[model samples]
Target: MNIGIIGAGTLGMTLGYRLSQAGHRVTVLETGAQIGGLATWFDYGDFTWDKYYHVILRQDEQLLSLIDDLGISPRMQWKETKTGFLWRGKLVSMSNNWEFLRFPVLSFPDKARLALGILYIQRVNDAGPLERVTAAKWLTRVFGRRVFERIWEPLLLSKYGVLYDRVPAVIMWATIRRYYKTRSKGDGKETLGYLGGGLKTLFEALERGIIEAGGSVETGAAVTEILAGEAPGVAVRVGDEIRWFDRVISTAPSKVLDRLAPETKLGAVSASSAPNYLGVVCLALVLKRPLSPFYVTNLIERGMPFTGVIEVSALTGTDEMEGNHLVMLPRYDEPDSAWFERPESEVATEFLHALRRVIPDIESNVERFFVHRAKHVQALWIKEPPKEQGPRHTADGRIWSVNAEMAGRDTLNNNAIVQVANAAAQAIGAMGAPAKAPTAAASRGR
Candidate 1:
């Protein structure tokens, strides 16, 4: 089978490796110069690390299995990470039961409701009902109005921005459940894992496996059009070059794939009425010292520009970064938001100014700063439940949609991505794609 995978991110390369091992000629295409997508590495002057903060959780079975398969499990580093929450201009630890119980913002009734709600939702097998309800409504009902106003709403604003009010409760349920399940045993503190060289190591390993298995991974090769003509195969155009493929598996955002391959109508995959994705703009900084004792600090300060603070070096360690701390201030919003259009220096300055409220002496400890942005981070499902819980083969049955929208009730983590990759591999293996022959999919392979 001559398989063309659009986007050379973790999912695309994983698919490429699987199909190539199955004896298919695979080609992975990426628009950017780099491969890993959001998980790609960057040069931070003294060191290179993941552009965005990523960590392996204790409960990330799929990701762990992939790492083990890559023969890099021995290089895995694990640590008990602390979590903090800011409220009323004060930073407080909330990683344990005692700290949570001592959290003053919540009344006894509020605490009780919050506890019971969490206990109930943890056992929920289906997220359909949650998706029908908005997060604001669900939180207010389960955790009380005071808790919603004081803690949840502000926290939600950081991630969802303008869409917070319309976001489904299932997302919040899934996110909290994912986070809590990762808590290490005994002390209840979450244990996070990191590779020796970070996510770049994992991505590179996947890329290598694809190439070694006779597949090709091409970067800076933006696939502009995919035409499933009246002919036998799909014709893909990269610049002026048009090539035929037995089957096309697009890991692109739903909307993007629709534009690339309009032949499918793609309604079964993503409709025109579907919600737009929430993009991320992160203001990353290297510091001479750690900003906080906790790796993640959930922000609630009303005027803070960014949502939360991630002390990535706390989990990754300063050893790989010349003993300098790496922290990221990320804002999640619409891709075309005014903030995204603003100057990078202006965004950095605003974020830094607000950060001082949490860390009074931050400027003195800062070493270097960088800005990273991604337009399609994850689909933002608002008000209504998604029509289909998983990606479907388009009407033509030639293009497979394996994107984030297919991840039912799960957070956008590497584990979920690996699960999607494995599922797609199994499904495609059952299909009767064209016989394995010349590598038309990667005719211009690097």
Candidate 2:
């Protein structure tokens, strides 16, 4: 079967590799010069680093399995990571039960409520009617207003801007539960995993697998339109050439895909109002000394223009070629936000201000800085939800839709990838002599 994938991010690359290995002709269309999408890396003359802050949870099995499958198992490394909350002009360690108990911001009763709320979310499998339920109202009701105001609201406002109230309570619960489950032992310490060099190694390996299996990956080839006149096939427009495929799996954002597929009324798959994504300018510093021993710090003070989840270089256990430290400051806001398009000097001033507050530093110790911005980081998908509508996957005859945002229930999990891969295979495989027997859906590929 001829399959065309719209994007080449981790999800796209992984799917392409698996499907190509199943003896189908696979082709990937990437608009960017490089692959990996949000998981992409940039070279800084001396070292290569990710444009935005990225770290894997200890439970990221798909990434782990992919590393080993590519024969790069030795490159995978893990470390006991620490996180802190910056509140009232001090860094309060919040990575453990003991520290959480001692944190001074919340009242004793409020702290207890927060604790109970965390447990409730983890234990409760079904979050009933969470769509109509807003996170702010739900949290404040369960954990009191102080917790919501001090910790939760700021984080939501930082991530979602004015749409903070639109986030469902279940999202908040799911995020917390996911975080709790991925910690180190019983201590609340976060465990982080990183590939030796960067995720580019993994992306390259997946690319190789796809090509070796007779799949073609076309870079800088953006599909302007997808014609679905033929049953079980799509006509993709490339410059002047039109390529046809038996099936199309779009990993591109639904907003982008909606424009490409004109034959169907894509039913709110392309949202009327875009959900806000923070534009990030990552300043990767090769410092003479490490900034902080901790891996992440959530900015709690108001006036600090950025709330970055910092990644200390030495912690990821990568080789320090120059014996220098690596640190990244991620600033999230709308693309049109003043900071996103700020002049270099103004942006540098903000970076220095945030750094000085956290790290006791000499201005002379700075080594390097780089800025990167992703226009559409993640789908805002800001609909009121018991059921949060991402992209709609209408069964348009032979045109089967498999996108990252539409992979139901299991998100960012290896199971989700495997599930979509199997579903697409089955959907396409059932289409007569045009296809071959694909691998059966399993937790792990044989």
Candidate 3:
């Protein structure tokens, strides 16, 4: 089948790799200058690393298997890392069970409820029921109101604003299940994996594999229209000309598809059911000194401006950053938040000023700083089994949705996305897609 994929993010790239390996002619289209999507590489002067902070857990089997397939598994490395919790003008390490017990902020009962709830949620094999339940209700029931207010509530507020209560419990369930990897070894330490050269290594290898396997990848080639052609053939508009394909799978947001895809063919989903996205505004810094001892310092203090602090260098090692440190202060702003439009300088200053309260020496230790922003990064699910997910294929059965909540309820990660891509390929193949093109046709138009 001649397949056209929209949004060459990890989901798109992985889908392309899988489909090509399955003997389909694939062309992955990306609007950005490069692939990786959220996991794209950023230029940090002397070196480059992931555009946002990302990590690989020991349980990330899908991602690891893909790395092996790309012949780059040798570059993968694992290390022990610590997690930090900051509150009341102090930073505390919460990497181990003993530290969690000794933590002063929460009462013994609160801690017990929190720990016990996590243990229970981690073992739950089925989280489908959680889709209809609000995270607030589930958390309140399992961990008690006190724990919810003391710990999880602030995080929800910081990320989702007033819509926090509307978030599905499945998100929470997925998070706990994924997090169990850190302690599954029975050790107090949290071990994380990373490719030696960061995400760039993985993506580069993926692109190579896709091309070598008779697939093509395009960057800065945005698809503005996806109209259904003769049955089982789709027409994708890149510039002035329209290219036809046997099948088209889009990883773009539902709203985008609502505007671009031929709604009359498959019909458009209601706007109300599409999840609103939480865009992130981050102050990325190349620091002369590390910000905190932990890789991630969850901020719980009242009135804090940002969501959390991540010292990426802590996980990858400072030597990778040319002997400097890498820090990111990310704030997941609501859809209507002004941070998306505010001046980058102003946002950076505000984040740094608020951060200085905790790390008074922050500005002094910073060698370089960059403000980065990406809208539509994190999906905010307000309803269970979103209306858009009811049908993976359109009425014509030519267009398919790949990453659209069809990926199922899993914590947002490369590994989960890899598995989603694998599932998509298997489904497409099982449906008996047409024969692959002897050679990929060239994309026309500028």
Candidate 4:
């Protein structure tokens, strides 16, 4: 079988590797200058690291397994990281029971309730009922109104904005469960893992494995159109040339597919509606000194610009970063938000001002700064069993759409993307011969 996979991100590349290993010929097309998609990296004069903030928890079995298979497990390192919360203009530690007990934001009774609520959520093996409820309703009911308003509400508002009320409870449940499962039994502290050289090492290994398996990986190959081929396969137009394959798997966003193949009945699978995505404007800084003792600091203050402060240097050693701190300030908002239209200089200045409120002396410690923006970093999941639920295969089972937005009941992360791609490969392999490629006459009939 000959397979053509569009968008050479983690999902696309992983799917390509899996199918090629199954004795199929594969060709991966990517629009970007490099692979890895959201997991891609940027070279800072001194060192290269992920463009966006990313961390691996001990509970990420699927991601860990993939790294092990790629022979990069030894290069991975684990660190006992701490978490903090900024409330009432104070940065307080919340990584352990002691710190949490002393947390001044919530009363003692409220803290107990918060702990019990997390325990209950962790024990919840089935999240079906939770899906029917919104995070606002479910959390307020479980942790009470005070705790919800003080702790969770601000965090949700920061990440989801106006869509905060529509976010399903399953999303929150999955988040708590993932972190809870990663805590060490002895100290009950969270431990995070990172690769020696970062995600670059892992992505390079996947690309090399695909080529070694007789598959071709092409970057900067923007796919303009996807049409029916002359035979029982799909044809993809990359640049000016059109190439046909026995199968096509698109890891691009659903909107891209809607534009390329409007005749196809995508139904609810298409993300052509408003409030479907959450964009991110991230500011990463290479600093001469560390910002905070914790790896993550959730801001509870209202009207703050960025969501949280992710000090990547806390989990990663400074030696690898060329003796500089790596900090990322990410703000999630609607794709059409006025923030996206702001110039980089304006965004940086505003972000720096807000950041100073958390780290009072951060201005002088900065060595270099860079900004990155993504229009569709996260998919808003207000609907139960997302419109594009289940395997990537469409109704006709010829073309497949696999991307982070399609991840149901799971957060959009590298591990979940790999899981989705693995499942897509199985479904595509089990299906019958590819459907007849759409010819001009056949396209008109639809």
lDDT of 4 at 354: 82
Residue ranges of candidate 2 with Cα displaced over 4 Å = 229-233, 267-281, 312-314, 318-322, 360-362, 384-400, 407-426, 430-446
For model 4, how does the per-residue alpha-carbon lDDT over 118-155 read when each residue is reduced to its tens digit? 88887889888997999999999999999999999998
- Put down candidate 3 lDDT per residue, 1-446, tens digits, no spaces: 88889988888988898888889888898989989998999999988989899989988999899999888999988988899988888998888888988988799988888878888887788877888888899988998988888788877776666678888888878887787767744656788889988989988887888899888899988889886745646778987777777788888776777778746433255355656677888889999987878998887776877888899998989878899999998888776788889888898888888888888988899888888888877766666655444337765457877674554466567887788788888887777764442233533331
Q: Model 1 residue 424 lDDT?
A: 90
Most lDDT-accurate candidate: 4
User: Candidate 1, which segments miss by more than 4 Å at Cα?
Assistant: 267-269, 383-387, 394-396, 435-446
lDDT of each candidate versus the true structure: 0.81, 0.67, 0.80, 0.83
* Model 1: residue 427 alpha-carbon error in angstroms: 1.3
TM-score winner among the candidates? 4
TM-score of every prediction relative to native: 0.93, 0.86, 0.92, 0.94
> Candidate 2 on 1-446: residue-level lDDT in tens?
66788888876887788787678878998988999887887776566766555666666665666677778889777777878777776777787778888889888888888888877777778866665688889888877888889888887776556567877676676667767876755766667777777778788888999999888888899878777764544567877777776667777666677788745656244455444344455556666666666788777676676665575674664363345566776666666767767786677677777667656573567777666666665444445421443334446443445565555323234435545554555555555333332222310111
How many collisions per candidate? 0, 3, 0, 1
Candidates 2 and 3 compared by lDDT, better number: 3
| Candidate 3 local lDDT, residue 418 | 84
RMSD of each: 2.6, 5.5, 2.6, 3.5
Residue 200 of model 4: what lDDT?
89
**Candidate 2, TM-score vs. the true structure?**
0.86
